[model samples]
Target: MPILEVTKITKQFGGLTANHNISMHVDEGSITAVIGPNGAGKTTFFNMITGVYQPTSGDIKLNGESLLKLKPDEVAKKGVSRTFQNIRLFGEMSVIENVLIGMHTHLKTNLFGIFLNLPATKKEEIEAEKEAYRLLKYFGLESLLNEKACNLSYGAQRKLEIARALATKPKLILLDEPAAGMNPKETKELTEIIKRMGEEFNVSILLIEHDMKLVMEISEHIIVLDHGEKIAEGNPKAIRTNPKVIEAYLGSAAIH
Candidate 1:
């Protein structure tokens, strides 16, 4: 079975329908991209998948289990993690602390245990910190462990958000406009990191990106949306040449 299956899902806010019967599947250990112009409802789909919004119709299955009704935290527990389009880090917290927060679902300590300073709780805290440090090192941010999240460079901050998402140990991760504010160098690094996240960590990715270069370079499959509906779904070559996709968003000049 696919890692995630989105079947005819639709979302409406009263008269405004943001998504219209959208369907797609994310294969295990593969990278998928969703692309379109602004207001194409790419973020809306992410919101539904991550449980930020309840779909008006259809089903979402992760590993064959229904996720339509689950809450965001519940979705995370079910092996789905995501980063926002706009950076949403704990500005006042240390970089490591922000990552540790993502591992909350795996923590074994209870509040009661912590209040009394039990041995098991202490051990769990130590292990969590160790795991957090490992994740930071993996992302090459180990040296910034003591720095506040807001203090990191823009590129580093973007990577930090991804690192935090990975700390959840999710089977699938949804990234919304990850390269939005990045420079060419940062975008290049992000491309490599995204590839590694799938190949090295075995995590499936569903990305919403506007950068055609990044989208075509990294995604195994690309889905195009236009005005709240899917217009095309295919490999890079096919999507690049698709007449409908061209008319909808990617102009003829974008193919090069």
Candidate 2:
């Protein structure tokens, strides 16, 4: 069964319908990409899935359980995590500190236990730090752990945001335009990291990215949306050549 399933979901804001009967699925341990033009409602679809916005009509299921009623934090606790199109980091906090905050949902300590710094709570805290450090290391941000988030370079900040999301230990990670601002080298690095994440972490990746190179390179399956409607779904080779896909977003230059 697919790890994340969005079934006939639609959203409207007053008079405008943002998404219309959009349905797609991300299988376990796979890399999937949702691509489209600027106003194609890709982000809106993601918002519905991550609980940033509840679907106006239809159900979203994670592992077969309905997530329509869950709040954003509740969705995170259910093993769904995401990074925004715009980097949302604690600018004043250290890199590791930001990642540690993501672990708040998984922390077992109660208010009383935390206030007293109980031995058990302390032990869990230590482990959480180790896990955060490991994630930083994986992203090659270990050396900057103590550095303030705002002090890091743009690319590093992007990686840090992803690290924070990974700290949540999610079964599925939604990346909104992860390569939105990066040089060719940084985009290349991100492609490898995203592929490794799915293979090594056993986490499913669902991303909305306009970087055709990264999307084509890493996505195992592709979903193309146009004006809030799904236009195509297939592997990269097929999507690259589908006439509708070409006309909607990826122009003739996309294939060559």
Candidate 3:
């Protein structure tokens, strides 16, 4: 079953079409990837899916319900969560606090309850803190739970962003260039972590990445976009050998 579906969605900024009629689907509990060179409308596509930008045409659905009219926060509440291409963490906040913020959309306690320190509110707060700690531990950051996000190493910060996204318990999570600044060792570890995340976190994964090694090794399906249009899509082997994908994004040497 598809957890998310985008049908011929397009985005226009005046006369500029950042995304042409593009369509794709991500199966529940699978890891899929969107790949292309810079300016291929990849980020624009992500924006549309996450409700950062509304599509000029076509529909986006989650669990078969249309998300076309929803704003970013609304979409998030509907079980969609995402990480930006550039890491967007709360640098001034403690690592654990950052993860707690991601849980806000689904938090059960009302502000009034919290303000009054009701028993239910206190119970919810404790559970939220426990969940946040578990997420931090999953990323091996439990030891640094109280450290400022800005004080963490670059790779740790990347993992923290993903941990926070998982905090939402999303049905679908989109990662934009999650490996952008990682060294080989960190990327390798991330590949294994991503491979297990669907099962461990119970969420489907859709990602935009330039790392072919990571994409090929972990993605069950791949979509290639170039110049604002989809050029090819297939499983790892088919995508690796596709001429259009090779020419447009992967280059001729992609076949191995």
Model 1: per-residue Cα lDDT at residue 84: 94
The TM-score-based order of candidates, best leading, equals 2, 3, 1
Better of 1 and 3 by TM-score: 3
| Model 3 local distance difference test score | 0.93
* lDDT score for residue 115 of model 1: 100
Runs with alpha carbons beyond 4 Å of true place in candidate 2:
none
> Candidate 2 vs. truth: CA RMSD?
1.1
- The parts of candidate 1 lying over 4 Å away from their true place are none
Across 1-256, the per-residue lDDT of candidate 3 in tens digits comes to 9999999999999999999999999999999999998999999999999899999999999999999879999999999999988899999999999999999888998979978999999999999999999988888899999999999999899999999999998999999999989999999988998998999999999999989999999999999999999999999999988888888854566534
Per-residue lDDT, model 1, residue 224, is 90
Compare candidates 1 and 2 on lDDT and give the better one.
Answer: 2
Listed in order, each prediction's TM-score against the native is 0.96, 0.97, 0.97
Scored against the true structure, residue 50 in model 2 reaches a CA lDDT of 85
Clashes of each: 0, 0, 0
lDDT of 1 by residue, 197-239 (tens): 8876779999998888988999999999989999999999999
Residue 222's lDDT within candidate 3 is 94
Per-residue error for 44 in candidate 3, Å, reads 0.3
lDDT of each: 0.92, 0.92, 0.93
Model 3, poorest ten-residue lDDT window? 247-256
